[model samples]
Target: MLIALLLAVATVPAGQMFACTPIRVWDGDGPVWCREGPRIRLGGIAAREIDGSCRRGQPCPRASGIAARDALVRLLGGARGRSGTGHILVTGPRLQCRSTGNAKGDRTGAWCSAPRIGDLSCAMIATGTVLRWQRYAAGHCR
Candidate 1:
């Protein structure tokens, strides 16, 4: 019994170690979406609410998808001029969105759950002509 208990205790910490980091949608324009494993992040229709409803009569902006992709690439520390892809270590879902006012008006947005320590695709809504992003480290659970 003593040997069994000791072996179990030794394995606990190793089991807790995560292989993948949680990546959550921070913010973006259009219909923002993401996928894990061969990660593909895309921006969809521009919406005014959390449910992703495209505003009526609002034409898709030429720079919308570019803006979203730019935000993700910057967070991952990828090259500005190159369009290649690579893996990024994202640990949590703590994200925020800020927007620059365009000729029309200021945009608004939000995200769902906080990221967990696992593989996931994150997506969110964003407003403004310009979008900014920042990365945060995640804490271990007790």
Candidate 2:
């Protein structure tokens, strides 16, 4: 069942709406694994890599990678556990997301809104844990 869900969501066309229940969060900017099977990279923002480095030419916030990641976990209802592969499990509300399309690798690029958190990308930036990356952001952060 899960594999079927994954395969179905593997190619979300741009501007499509999808539901997400965040199960694990990898960082402030995301790769937020959803129970519905898509891995979402929060559209319009960038955070430090796990090693505290930003990709070249991207907007880099001053916060460390761990700090940024922890902030996101909290916003997503906090960490409940950790997956064996090191992803931090969370307890966030289901999100309503609009796919911008597939991102680098297998993740989807999307703008997601949580019940209380509103826009995940804007929320992350409001906290200063991440920065808006214009190239991919496409004015979504405004």
Best by lDDT: 2
Judging by TM-score against the true structure, name the best candidate: 2
lDDT of 1: 0.28
lDDT of 2 by residue, 7-126 (tens): 585746679788889999988888998888888999989999989998898888899988889999989999999999988999789999998998878898899997699888898998
Q: What C-alpha lDDT do the candidate models reach, one value each?
A: 0.28, 0.87
Candidate 1 C-alpha lDDT tens digits along 111-135? 2222331211132323232222222
Score residue 9 of candidate 1 by CA lDDT: 34
**What lDDT does candidate 1 reach at residue 57?**
57
Task: Give the deviation of candidate 2 from the true structure as CA RMSD.
Answer: 2.2
Tell me the TM-score of each prediction against the true structure.
0.24, 0.91
